[model samples]
Target chain A: MAYQFDFAPVLQHSDLLLTGAAFTLALTAVGAVLGIGLGIVGALCRAWKISPFDRLFGLYVEVIRNTPFLVQLFFIFFGLPSLGVKMTEWHAAVLAMVINLGAYSTEIIRAGIQATPRGQIEAASSLALTRLQTFRHVVLRPALTRVWPALVSQVIIVMLGSSVCSQIAAEELTFAANFIQSRNFRAFETYFVTTAMYFVMALLIRQLLMRLGQRFIVGRPR
Target chain B: MSLVKITGLHKHFGANHVLKGIDLEVAQGDVVALIGRSGSGKSTLLRTINGLETIDKGELVVDGAALHDGKGDLRALRQKVGMVFQQFNLFPHLTAGQNVMLAPTVVKSTSKREAEDIAKEMLLKVGLSDKFNSFPDQLSGGQQQRVAIARALAMKPKVLLCDEITSALDPELVNEVLAVVRQLASEGMTLIMVTHEMRFARDVGNKLIFMHQGRIHESGDPKTVFAAPQTPELAGFIGAVQEA
Candidate 1:
């Protein structure tokens, strides 16, 4: 007996797959924005050693980078309830994605910030720009422009990683894939489509981020 | 009237004692040149006047503000004193106009319209009126240094510091930058320069100070000093620079 390919069974569940994809994208949208924002603050602290937060964010990046994403999700979803902290599965999934991406983007952005030429800072200071002003006006955009590709890759990684949210019953794309496969007993077909969806999403997001970099970060002269 | 006064100035880089008990004075409208061998502390002394390098012991007064005590309003002092570097440190991410307009708009809160007008005027002065939108990397080193000069002048600084402003340019490119500095000097913009351009220093400087072993070994009118170096150190330095 040979494995027979069947499309009808998987096609019947298009509604579930679409909703699941929409959920995954929503989680990614929220995660990338907040995560990069958090990472910017973390990078500033780590790069400039901005007092108390430097040590705190340093510990955060180390811990999150060392641990597996699934464990972090479990800890947020399962372990936190034991300590009287309660959140929905959706909240836990989004929070885990944010923290994970935040740590990675922090390191990436800090590398960019640390690469800033020493003379640039001296020039800004000589022009009477204060430390904060220098960071905002002189140091930040170039740093972001340098690290944007890495940041975009990290975001895609987190989006794919969000598939693990299904284990916590978050009803994301992978959850729908699992639900469809279990009901119709069409494992191979369901997984094939799910994999394709993820591939397409990643490509689309990379294009979106590249356009964003050109428009806002690079701000290239016309 | 003296616009800058330094007395018993001292600076150290972890006991290197870069500048030792230096005393100097600059009057309004003076174009002073500092020339010396590398590691002789002439650059260190120039940096101290702008509060870029703090003094370990002594008094530095620029534009009526005391800077040595570490309590002076450094921003205010810097606003009144502009500096152009050998590297021409224009913000690479910004265009030439934005670079010139940055200080006036941000530090002084000049409106965008006013800042743009000032940038245009400064760029015109530097002969870069057409490069208002060019980024730093798009310009040659000489052009970048000229833009740096414009950026400094946009602040309307009472004094300008040039730290070997043309030293990083190619030999052929050096004169374009030097010409801008010469023009500024002729227009009575007080300038203190650390330079190796002997011809420039001789032609434009009203006073020339030669440093040796962390001290002003020779000081006088440029013509007098170059025509008859009072110290063997000055003679040797002039010889070495001229050979290069």
Candidate 2:
């Protein structure tokens, strides 16, 4: 039998697919803000290296980075229930995304912070700015500016990685595709359309984050 | 009384003794030039005065704030002593105006509007009125150096330390930066400069100091030291600078 492609059956559930896409977008947006925030803090803890945070964040980053995101998602979604800390599937997915992003970005932001020139620190100290003030104004901003492109790339990668949330049947775009295929029995058509949707999504998230970076960071000198 | 008084200042780096029992006094409005070959500790001496480098031994006081104890509250001393580096370390991500405004706003708690006004005035003083919004990479080496000077001046330091500020500039660019410094000198701002520019030292410094082997080998009026060459080390140093 000659195989024919049909997207009509999948398109029939447009409302379901659109809702799934929206959920995916929502998941990524929330994950990004929380993740990047966690990343900044982890990076600062590593950079400043104040006592317990030095060893703590270092170990945290190392552990999370060494482990696969899928395994971490499984541990959060499946493993945590045994420990008596229960959460919904959506919550677990967001938490996994956040934890993963934090570890990855810690190292990225640390590299940016380390590249700050010796002259800049000397200049800040000579001006009598406090250690906290120096990092907040002088050190952190340029560091972020330097590594912005890397940061944006990581954000999109995490967005794409959000597809794994479907493993727990969290009802993201991929889950919607699976549901449509199961209902219509057009497995090839459903999955192919879903893959294209993902491609479009990755591109959109990438452009949107880059635009945010431009508005807040690039070409606007402090 | 001298504005800056250092009696028996000593500094070490691991096993290396960089400054050996240095004794010097800088009066208010004195343009003092520290001249020596590399590794003579002239730069290190300037660094210690501004609390950038710690002293291994001796008393170092700048305008009533003593740093020899290593706990002498550098914050207060730093307000009165500003330093400009050889590298022209203007913050790369900030405009010249913002670079100048940072210290006052952050350290002194000046309002943003006030800091901006002061930054503009200092940039004007450095003769970079048109370059207030330009980033360091956008400007020439000379203009960047001038912005650095304006940044240092924005702190309103009583004694400005210049650590080979012009040594990093190209020959043509050196003069433009130096011209701004000379104006600061004539305007009665106290200056302690470590310089390789012998001609500038002879012309601008009211008092001259020569360092050799981590000690003040000779210190006197510029005309006397340049003409007489009291020590063979200084004479050799002058000869070396002339040939290069």
Q: Clashes in model 2: which pairs? A: none
Best candidate (score: DockQ) = 1
When candidate 1 is compared with the true two-chain complex, its DockQ is: 0.80
Candidate 2 yields a Cα-based lDDT of 0.90
Q: Name the TM-score of candidate 1.
A: 0.97
What tens digits encode model 2's per-residue C-alpha lDDT throughout A32-74?
Answer: 8999889888888898887888789899898998988989999
Instruction: Name the docking class for model 2.
Output: medium
Given candidate 2, what's the lDDT at residue B34? 97
TM-score of chain A of 2: 0.95
Q: Please give the C-alpha DockQ score of model 2.
A: 0.76
